[model samples]
Target chain A: MNVALRFDPVRLPDHCQDLRQEVRDFLREQVVQGVYDPTARSHGYEDICRFAKAVSERGWIGMAWPREYGGQERSFLERYVVSEEMLVARAPTRRYFVADRQSGPTLIRYASEPIKQRVLPQIIAGEAMFCIGMSEPNSGSDLFAAQAKATKVDGGWRLNGAKIWTTGAQHADYMIGLFRTSQPTRENRRHGLTSFLVDMHADGIKVSPIEMINGVMEFNEVLFDDVFLPDENVIGEIDGAWKQATSELAYERSGPERFLETFGAMRAFLTAVEGTDDTRLQEGLGRLIAQLHTMRRMSVSVAGMLEAGREPVTEASIVKDLGTVWDQALPKELRTLISLMDYDQYDVQAYRERMDFYTRMAPKLTIQGGTTEILRGIVARGLGLR
Target chain B: MALDSDDIHVATAERIFSDRADLQTVAHDRDGAYRASLWQAVEENGLTIAMVPEEAGGVGLTLEEAFSLLRAAGRHAVSVPLAETMLANWALAAAGLEIREGVLVPLVPAPRGHLAIDAEGRVTGVCPEVPFGREAGAFVALCDGPDGPVIALLDPAACRIEEGTALSYEPLDWVHVEGAPAMASAPAGTAAALPEMAATARANQIAGALERMLDATVQYAQDRRAFERPISKFQAVQHLLARLGEECAAAVAAAGSAADTLSRGETGDALLLEVAAAKVRCGEAAEAASGIAHQVHGAIGITREHALHRLTLNALAWREDYGTEAHWALKLGQLVSAGGADALWPLLASR
Candidate 1:
């Protein structure tokens, strides 16, 4: 199989410039209002919710979905511009990012009309938040090995297993949970798994915080003790979620968030060495900037492909793989360059603090959405090596 | 590799390269006998003057079409100076000078080697490591004249050509000149941005070479076997090829973005940023991809008999051609720093 990977050079449309200015103005207003610090590692939940609602009021959230679903019916490139602007600004988008990026799009495709009508409007209004329930104690990268059983009941299915590393589960309003409905067939081990839209406030569901090394409680272990999910909550075909799961990943993995996570620290680093005449630091900064620019171009190209109604799975994987690795290494490289400067020369203390946080956060960049190894395996499959 | 059949110019270039400049045939022709026929085929098809305007006695392809042709030349690892001739003709056309036929090379003076034009319009300076300088019939030199930058077309016989070879075995000679009369000259104007131009061209070539390297490495993995199975079955080899694919993708994206920027008739800082970034990124990708391709192919890749080194070595050499990674990286860093911290995102997102 001759799989010549193509990344057609896609320029942002003329309308996107206006959209970008709008986003920048909105973000600048938020910064001026003290909504959140763009350089901070995390934002308060109140500010996050406020920012999400503000973005939704502007019709930025769910802008790419249909108008019937409370969306603005804009192009995916418009959504891309807004998403990247928010990420680069380090805006508090944690509240509605998952729903807008992956869950909303998944519901638009797989969720029933009733469910879409019920939950999508709230998500589009930025009143709803979502956390994925794919990884468990044993199924980190091997998503099909999930043991979260959803036993059949009279009017619904009962979920009885736990999911680990569920980001934002403590405050999430909903979850698109994956559960094992039956045993895998010999022909396809990815069989028998199903997806359900579960209310996070439901009874018998417990969320325990998993504190990261950076002393952040962003991850959680969610336990469900026979929680009932109605039949109407089922998304797409039962026992065929494996097919649905892969498509959503293309959306999740190729966004600007994958690389812009450490951009705050990069900004801080530039500020720290603002006036230095060191050629080594200059060269390092240049290399980092170039890599970042290339990754952005690749990500934008993938978004363009999606806007053109094409599924660029391998291309998205390539972006995520390269983007994650670059971002994961960015903080360390910045630290080395920053270390070369005099400690008291500039505002090195704040820069060091930010770098410390980003360095701690870097380990999860490659592991969060999908591990680097899994991405490479996907690319290898695209190369027909499998 | 899947050719973009929709692009007729790219299709035509690919057809010619596959017919005349196949890697296997070019690799075995050690004495450079095929260079003449290959260049002849390119010139006869008007590929060298593809960038020159139609009003100026040349076949005028759009910037995008011309870049696509360069990519095809790189994919075939053609030893001829197709890209140089195209660039030289482009500079000549921009200056309203007569576009010459047959193997015209462009020479942009490096940081230390500054070629200067005297009051009499006599060009005097040594241009070190000029690609295809030994083989070209004429030199299109963007020199620093007394008044301003001047574009001078010089005869190869007027300069002393000390022949050298790049890592890919392409002739990259050092040309020494003392008061050589300019055959033709014009103000540089917008064409003074030859360094960025050359960087963009080299970036395109590197991207093309990386694509071919990926194709060749993947093919080899599926054919070469070990332990009763193809080595492609091994996870280690698969990962290596995956890394190669990533490098190739990065180079393509960066180079493609640069080409799009140039196509829009953008110059100054925007063009500088895109071209610098492309050169730096594609140069780094060349290093990574060449290393990975060689590793995957083992020792057989380094031998002269194998076709892998032709592309790999050329990619390696292309990294240093139009501003090495370090050179462009420093320039890019200065640009970014000068833009200040807050302007970084806006600048990147502008494109």
Candidate 2:
């Protein structure tokens, strides 16, 4: 039996270029106004919020959502253009990225009408920050192994357990957490888990920052010590989060962020080696650019699929697998490519700093969203091998 | 799967290829008997001249449709010069020349020793690695005309051919033309596009072959047993096959996008970037996939008896045909570098 794999050569819609330019202009203005340093590897908490709010004011966050929720009701392709431009420009999307990308959509789909009316608008307004609580200290890639309990109370669920590696948790206003509501059946190991919209500011929630190798304190160990979540905060069917989780993967895995994490290093390399007549340098840089372009095409194709209301799970996994792997190796590859060339010809300090930051950031690229092993398993299932 | 009007041609090509050019048949035939028959069937099905306009005495099909036919040809692992002939016919028609019947392989001469039109308008110079050159009734050469670039149909009988074969046992000959007689010649404004066209064709073919390889490897993994279970049950084997699937997807996306760009009449740096990136990406995928496909198959895949060679070897052979990955990589790299650091993202996002 043939596995039906379709990439479908999807080009961006004709009007996306205008939207892309609009995003570029807005980001340029941010840079000019000293809002965020494009050259910096990371930003402070206030910087991130200010930038996210500016983007939200432009109606870019949650752009594909309906107008009633403060969204622009734009096409996914338009949103894609906005997201990629923001990523490439190194705009601080830390505050609203998760909400705009996945959490907002999840809330709109599964949150109660009152919860949606309250939270979706806040997400659209960039007044809320969201973090994923799938990974625990025990379960990193194996999301089904989450041991966080959410026992039902009189009018709510009492949450207890720690979620480690929760990115931006310290600053998150809300968390779309996976909590165990029942024991997994022998037939389905992925059962018993339920997704809930946990209020981070609620009592019994403690967020402790986890410092990374790059000396950046981004991810946090979030402990849910009897945190109360009302019935309205429960998202989707109780103990049916597996179905919802898999569907959201297509949106999360295949985005510009998958590949553009090390774009600064590439830009630095280009600046360092600009005007070089050396053949080796050109060839090395060219292959990287080619791969980048191909990855973008695949990412855009996935966006096209999403726009057309098709869940391209397999295609999205493939894109993330290739894109993340390529991005992870890029810093080292660029290092090797520019090692032999004279450093004095370019901004050696800036290039070195960018490379240094990206080199530290590379290992987490594939591990963060979905590890290489997990993504490959998903792809194999898609290929009908398992 | 509803058959759209565009897919109708591709479907017919797929059907014809499966019937006459199935992997078992093509792999088993030592002689050219089966390949000859397959070529005959392909020509009879109007797949040979699909790129030429109907006004020029050939099937008027879009570039996308023609590419799909080539992709189907690739999936069957047919050794016929179908892609070359289609490209040659398209060039001939674009140049307002007569579209000849039979296998007329297009030659993108090596940059240094490329064929040229002399004072008497005859094609001259030594063009090497001319795929299926010996089997061709004529060689479609994009020559350097006195006025501009021109497309010249050179009679293969008049040329001295040094026969060669690729790793796949497909005909890849070197044709030396010392003022060879021109069957037809005309100024082709789009003559510079032949190389990119050829690259796009190879990219599509590589994409198709990769798909075939993935299918074959996945099936093999399922059937082959080890430790009382199918090899596919093993996580290692599944991951290898999954990696192969990723490469196949990348190739398909890159090649399909390039074909679309060419079909939409995009030219200049935009077309160059798309075609070059496609060739580079597909070539890289072929290299990576060929290894994974063979690794998954073990000893049997290396043997000539297995149909795996028919797909992998040809895909690898195409990596060097139009231009090696390094060759296109250099061109693309230079283009990107020349545009400077600030322009790279804009150029990439333009597509």
Candidate 3:
């Protein structure tokens, strides 16, 4: 009956610190080699995928997974170090991020041996990319309301529906898609859905890029017209994906990416304010940095909980809620502080551009993965309100 | 990451607070028995000197254990200077000064305060507001000495004391010193660290108070009916409580992280970053969650008879203790700016 939520202090161990430095050095070297431009603010498929391959060679992708699956079997804290470093450096980890964070782990937990043998190594090796096909046009936040169907066939299920706002779907080699495998019981609307590992290269699958407000083409509309997924592709129990999906959210919703999305803007803001005695600017940066530091602590705590085999669903949701909101506000808050500075004195034109880019990207922060509303609901349920 | 063996301390605190300092008991206690009994229990448990090293004639609990204890005191919104006394003993002990017993309040003179020590080691200064100061047997003052920082244990009987009250009606007294001889004075490194310690302590208390507020508000929402159903069933109410939950989580995380950092013996910018971040974050959370808690509770929440005000008002008052969010935020901002942009991430990731 205690409504207290726990986010225990989870300091990354010495190993994470060592891994962090290596990541920073690697990223710095990549920047020097023109593998990617930190100032460019965005990286395309080729640049990101190549960088992913290099990162994988360092045994970072799926570093927390088992060695038999081409992983280092490192702690989640170590993986967390790699993630936050990639994010802060703007290293375009999109190619391996999903797979490293969730998909590979999901496969390890539930995939068939052949599927695990085939996919996890590719995922760990950074050869394969994965996308989550959860949001249909009508069922973005209301995930259980997804009408995407997968009718049973002789040897598999035939998928027929569409998933919108699927990030990186165009280049995805696989998708952990949620589809209707049975009718919903009156008692439980969430009981009917099933999750499948669909081969993206299948004949009936189609991927169309969708441009976002930030001018990024990462979002996609994936169409499944008779796209067949074999029996082995089913993850865990059929018609019980609600259970798996809920568990997966703890990993997806809490991460450095939730709060560090607009870190570039913050870094630029710091550059602009450096060597200046502007109280307003310093105070602004201080507040943001404080919030950012706290978010990282919370995120790390959740990661530690996961490492210890505890399901910190509520804590993870709270992280995403607070983190996304803070990240979303970073640009707007920076803009106010920037207004107080003399542009010519600070030489902040590039900083201004970074702020603009983050401003456009901010809207989706609380919407993707889990909308703020949905996250709040999850937190509410955690509070025993539901 | 669970408290594990530290659970004994938290559980002890929980037991003590529930028995002697429950909201209703403290709210309506006209005879001051509740406050006195709570203090007695805390003292009996040897919690006041928990931060002082065992070799220094005290319990010598780890800073982490002590903080968890403070947070437990916070859950009941106990309006005593438990944190101040613990911190005072800690500072005195760290300075190798004899630990003072009985209601010891701390005084870390504001940057602008007139508190000073002359060559003769006589204390001359004024602390405009000190929580539980009127009742303190002795005052632990961290001030500038001619050579460096010094920690002085001052006898209240020699100094002028005036009683005041915070918004929560707890004792917020004023103390004046006209070159009063210190009972004991020692050159202390803890002087410079006092503010951060005090702020971190307040952050821990605020985090605890916020958690209690969330608990109370959520309970109230469920029990209070509106439009033919429990108000909690409404999405608006649930979301507000949810946001309150978020604030509580952030506050706890921030405070806990700061406590962990201090317990590890970190100092300088490393210590400043964590403590400043904790104070600022917890202060913000207190302000935010306090309002949401009241909003969810409605008219009764504002009434004196209601216990909700104790938690909310104390949280607000604690937000100003040691340093307000703005105070620490500005300090933190200056620190970050000094490090420059390139060094910022490394500073944050240092933990």
Candidate 4:
């Protein structure tokens, strides 16, 4: 069997250069105004909301969507440039990044017309926030094993289970959640799940904060205690959410955010090594930069494939697999290189502090989204090994 | 410049390779006689001079097309100097020299023997590890001259050839030219940037070879059985193959981007950055992927009887050609360092 994986070289278009420049200018202004700190691990909710509003006003949020829902009808590549710039700048994108990246697109594709009319506009206006509720206490990587049940009621469904590791759920206005609706068949273990759009403000829903190892409450355990959802809130096919779930993996996996999450550490490392004539340090830095460049190229090529209306599931999984592994290892590698340097020679205190935080954040890089093990399994199947 | 999956040139080259240069057949040919016919087939297809202009008495294919063809040549691990010939012809054409009919190899004067040019344009140097230097009829080299760099086409017969072989058993000979007369010489012109060009060529070759390696390893994993099932069913073996896939993807992306950059006629810092990154990244991929491929195939991978050795050994050998990971990494590091810390993101994002 042919196991060749294609990552076609795709250069950003000329227009993307202009868009990138505009993003840089806007980010620079934000930095000067002290709207958010690029070096910080997290931004305040107000800062995130303000920055999201500013970015939405520029027609960047929901950029790749149709213009009917406040989108600009821009290309995925253009949206790619915006997302990468925001990530590199470490902008306060926490409020709307999930909605812009996946939730809005998911709703556009599967939501009812009324839901789209109500939610897409709010998402595009930066007034709405979304959190993904896929992982539960027992179904982190094996998502098909999700036990969050949704039973049919008079006019809607009643959800009565807890979803763990629900990022941004406490602050989100809505959540795109998966609920088990029926039993799985012997042939297809992935059968019987359904997707629902949950209103966070709905009664019987409680979000309990879960503090991470990094001393951040960035995720939560969302408990749905007999929460009633209108029948119209169901997304796509009932007992067939598996189909919709797999289709979005390509878009969600192959993105700039997968690799650029710890790019701030790289920037800080560069600052510490500035003016050093050491060849060893330079070589290490060069290797890191080269790896980053290759990852970016692969990611961009996947974006181009997405633009061509092709679903490159395996290719996108390969990107995430490689990107997450590299990013997870980047902080430790940088730490090793910095450990060899003379401490008094350079002002590396700030960089060291950032490295400490990044080291803590690095473990979650591969664990979040699709774990490395699961991604590798997807890649293996793509290689026809399954 | 997205990779052209349906390029005619690549398809043609693939056809030639699949027909004439099957790895198993070539591996069994201990006498190495299959190389002549394979080289003749490739040369007759006008692939060697594909990068040269038609007006210059060459095939005149675009750089992208030529690199695609080279990538195909690499996938089969054809034991000849196809990439060398292409680079040589490109250098000769850039210097406005006549294209030679037989095998041509381009020599980059660094990390090996040195070459000096006198006022009369006679070349003197001993360049080592020139790929296929012993078999090549002529050599195209960019020599350091009294004025500047000079591009010269020299007869290989005039030089002393100390025959050598790389890990892949390809001809890698050292040539000592004691005041050998130049067949044709001119200002280096575009040929002066031979290091980056060579790196780009080797990067493409490494990418192609890595792809084939991945294919072979995956096939082996599926066919090989353990515990009454295919080893591929094992999660460990599957993950290993997946990592191999990642390395192959990285190599392809780096090399493809560099090829795209070169095809656009980028030079200097832009060219240096891309080519260096490609070489460094692809070289790293080669190192990591080869080990994993060997591990997946077990004992069969290391033996000469199996065809896996052909691709894996060549992948390792190609890492040292043009420039090693360390070599290019140093150059790239210095470049990045010179640009300072604030410029790093913009420089990377500019691509």
Fnat for each predicted structure, in order: 0.72, 0.76, 0.81, 0.77
lDDT per model vs. reference: 0.88, 0.88, 0.87, 0.88
TM-score of 1: 0.98
Q: Order the candidates by lDDT, highest first — what do you get? A: 4, 1, 2, 3
lDDT of 4 by residue, A267-304 (tens): 88888888789999999988888888889989999999
lDDT by residue (tens digit), candidate 4, B3-26:
454678888888888788899998
My TM-score estimates for the predictions, one after another, are 0.98, 0.97, 0.97, 0.97
Which is the better candidate, 1 or 3, if ranked by lDDT? 1
lDDT of 2 by residue, A276-312 (tens): 8889999999899899999999999999899999888
Chain A TM-score of each model, in the order shown?
0.97, 0.97, 0.97, 0.98
Off by over 4 Å in 4: B2-6
Alpha-carbon error at A224 in model 2, in Å?
A: 2.0
Instruction: Report per-candidate DockQ.
Output: 0.64, 0.66, 0.76, 0.76
**Candidates' interface RMSDs, in order?**
2.6, 2.2, 1.3, 1.3
Predicted chain A of candidate 4: TM-score: 0.98
TM-score of model 3 vs. true structure? 0.97
